[model samples]
Target: FHDFLSVLLCGHKIQAKLSSNDKKLLPFLASYLCAVAPEFKPFITFTEDTLKNFDAVIATGSNNTATYFDHYFSKYPHIIRKNRNAVAIITGKETPKQMQSLADDVYRYFGLGCRNVSKIYIPQQYNLDHFFNGMYAWKQVINNHKYINNYDYNKAVYLMSDIKLFDNEFMLLKEDTGYSSPISVVFYERYKDINDVKAQLEDQKQNIQCIVSLEDVPFGVAQTPALSDYADGVDTIDFLIKL
Candidate 1:
């Protein structure tokens, strides 16, 4: 939103209509925006009614809300975001420090961020010890009551379903093909070849946010995206300029 505002301000005067499911967040966010750009204060609003009259919209919402945005804003120029997950490529050759960094990337924000590493692709016959040891750095997350509840619940459900999992006393790792994993859990899948994993990920690019690897995003920095690192790989500034 800030980037869009910056680009839009380069030309015409702007009126920003803001609406959030968390009503309390709007006031704080609006105030912060005003602090950053005082000129935005008068032009900003908290009403959804004004949104319909906007010439263009850039919306980020939940899967259900995105569907609504797609239909309701179809008449206008818009950018609507859907759900996306991040995955890590585990080659089993990472140094102890890199392994720790990968763990930090996954457990940061308690694995709630869209860019958090929720799944991993590892080579066949890879040792799990390296991953588990690295994850020990975030064992404190298991002490958070909300996080622990989800952890225990997910552990019981997986056990009851007879699903195989790697238990680390804090985080659970299971072999699965899905991208999004539950809180306190991460999904992993073994690959016979790196090329195959890359090919598969390419086919699912639309559903993926970032590919964390020694080569791609580097470990422990998924949440700290550079200005050029646009979400869903779409260049927002460029898109806004094109508009």
Candidate 2:
């Protein structure tokens, strides 16, 4: 549902490939078109074998599925996407409003979309109190059943294994090296050098959708992707034009 919602919100920016692990979305998409598609408008194709007919293809899925698409679509012109995430870098100088806005980037869409900020880079010795002050505004997310359920599940698993986590009922923060976080959880890493962190991020550029910072895409704007903001930094227009 999150994937479909993301497609509905941002798919028009480029030719989107809506991938489902199962073919469950077929009926749903078809039903939606039947209900809302206007009579004068042309119909979009609905097909079981989507890959065979298209001249070129764009596929989105998990890291493992990406490898499968690469092998199968190598002969054809295609784009195969792997999992990616957005992250924020904190300098501890941000105002309460800035942190509040950052909370929106973290909590909006329940943090399921790729553009959602799932990790944070903060300076050493940064005060957690200030960061929590900003994040506190979004505490109401715990009231959501789905979000709370995920929170409980992840928290239980971690606690059973004796893992340490910094949490405030609704959100969990863990010091980790990974870029991706599980639902209802966010990873955090402390950084001493901005340039060093930038270099590190560049090393793993393919796994990142975007960087959220005061200097880059501002807080609360991750969901509002622009025409040029192609996922994984692939220029879809250039790729299409060349094809």
Candidate 3:
């Protein structure tokens, strides 16, 4: 929605159909936006049929929803999106400050946003003490009832299933190949070579939103995307210009 908000500035008529699940929070959000930008009030509507005549479409959601959007809107000029997650590459050489920043990037939004780092790649045989120490700063996140509930539940399930886990009270670190981890958990994989990790990431590029490391988007700042840093690496402005 933030990206498409620019469409209005370009003098294009823009409206959105709110999904059934998003109704809980989107109405309040729309009301707040309308309060500040009255011109935006009319562009939001609850009726799905109101968007039947749109010239172009921008759809974002899970993979299943993306499939449905592509099927329905394929005839139109559209940018349908699937879920994408950010990841971090951790070298053993990071300073404590950088580690802390990475922790903030992972925990800032309680690891819910697509830009949040849901996984990390660490060097083989790397000591995790530094990482755990950095994460201590966000230990207070356990105070959130919802977050702690997830933490406790996932921890118990993992323990009962005999899955090895690294527990930090508030977060669980699991070794897994997946990108999207459960709430309060961060999936991880060990890398013997950095180039191998890079190759795997390239192979799975469509599933990844951003790479956080010293060489890529930095340790922290994944959620703090610049206006031009388009989602899924698709340049919306360029798409608009071409259209």
TM-score of each: 0.89, 0.83, 0.90
Per lDDT, the best of the predicted structures is 3
Write candidate 3's Cα lDDT for 1-243 as tens digits: 665455655556666677675656656776888899998866765556657667788888899989998998889888888999999999898999889989888998788888899999999999999998988888999999999999999999999999999987788999999999998999999999999999999999999999999899988799898888889988777666666
12-118, model 1: which lDDT tens digit per residue? 33544554534676567768889998877766665645555567777777789999989999988777888889999989879888888988889888887789999
lDDT against the true structure, per candidate, is 0.83, 0.79, 0.86
- The TM-score that candidate 1 achieves is 0.89
Give residue 208's error in model 2 in angstroms: 0.9
Off by over 4 Å in 1: 1-30, 48-50
Worst 10 residues of 2 by lDDT: 7-16
**Candidate 3, position 228, lDDT:** 80
Report the lDDT of model 2 for residue 86.
Answer: 96
Q: Model 2's lDDT to the true fold?
A: 0.79
Which pairs clash inside model 2?
Answer: none
lDDT value, residue 136 of candidate 1: 89
Model 3 lDDT at residue 164: 100
